[model samples]
Target: MNRKAFTLIELIFVILLIGVLSAVAVPKFIGMRDNAKITSELSTAASVQTALEACHGEWVINDAPFVCGNGIRSDSADFNATTGYPVTLGSGDDTPLDKILKNGATVHWKKSGENYYGPASDPQNGTSRCIEGKPCIGKCWRYDSAEGTLKLQTSGC
Candidate 1:
């Protein structure tokens, strides 16, 4: 007798191999995706920082006028008097920072005192080491208006 078919034992072995491979590969893929999101968020934050610096440069070149656009020297509504950076990102198409940061479509920004916080690309539950043990859903990027610094909270992401 001649046969050309996989036996039940052979099929079972194939299935087990596939399962093992999937188990090992899936977590790595997920980790990579999370890492990518973190990188993207950090890049966006850096862009915002650069824009802030440019605005300040212009402000300095123009003699640091107290009142410029809309009676506000800074680009956004949440202008920080100390660092010359927007404490809170503005909404609307006309807002300067909105145009610079792409209208918060990718990152939602809010201000608390002189600090600005934005949502991370991915929402995960963890504590960010950078934010005084603050619990973050996704990742959180904190911008310090006084020091002109940006901090990334990647524990959640």
Candidate 2:
């Protein structure tokens, strides 16, 4: 009586165990994927911020006020026209978040405040609350029209 291989019952049990483990791992993997997407989008936002600072530098150097708040010129050297920002770093349009979602990149962008830029869905967990629902300055960001700077809210989520 040599037990040469796993019995059918043992095979079934192992299969079931693997199935259960996979089921548990899959959701976590999906969540991580979504979080990674969100993090990349946030990085795009930071890029936009850097471009904006450069635009301000141009203004300081008497180059004129290039557009801010969205993408930069596809070629920064071509920022002379009144069309908008240059066109080197990024497109002169909505923020990168907007570009990703609107261009059907399998992600979406919404904001806690009117001016804030992030995902409409919960960025961190994707199941928690999305927007804080307070006004821009109160909850997400503040546009100091006088200083022309975007001030993150005290919460600064």
Candidate 3:
């Protein structure tokens, strides 16, 4: 009888090769994942901006006041408050960015929740800080009104 099977040496070599490949591919995969997170954050920011603009137009025309966050929410109207740009919004729930980027990412807020932005979420502990040099990403977006941008930067995963 003839049996076809991998020899012990061949199996060992295959395992070593796999180990090597994994060692090389793991970091690259992690980096790609981080980049995907950043992309998602950018898209979310764009939506928030669009919502703010739309809310602003309506508020201006109807003379109404409301807040714009992840979603459009309004109570009644703030008769005492001035008519201006709506506040920014966030996921409200803690996000995957928090766990995955605990070391190399952060979220920032520019003026207020009204213009929050930054590295998708907060860094782990001492890895990074907002452009303002503050530790953010708990429940806000780092804001940069001067440049009119909300960035979510990461340290290459």
Candidate 2 per-residue C-alpha lDDT over 1-157 given as tens digits, one digit per residue, 9 for 90 to 100: 9778998999999999999999999999877765664455445445545654565565555544344434433235534343333333223333324321234233332333223333323344333323344222123433221243444343544
Off by over 4 Å in 1: 59-100, 105-107, 120-139, 153-157
Q: Report the candidate with higher lDDT, 2 versus 3.
A: 3
- The ten-residue window of minimal lDDT in model 3 covers 96-105
Judging by TM-score against the true structure, name the best candidate: 1
How far in Å is the alpha carbon of 124 misplaced in model 3? 4.3
Residues 116-154, model 1: lDDT tens digits: 666644355332332333323556676776776777675
Cα shift from native, residue 42, model 1 (Å)? 1.8
> What residue pairs clash in candidate 1, if any at all?
none
Please tell me which model should have the higher lDDT, number 1 or number 3.
1
lDDT of 2 at 74: 27
TM-score of each: 0.57, 0.43, 0.44
Runs in model 3 lying further than 4 Å from the true structure: 59-84, 87-120, 123-157
lDDT of each: 0.58, 0.43, 0.45
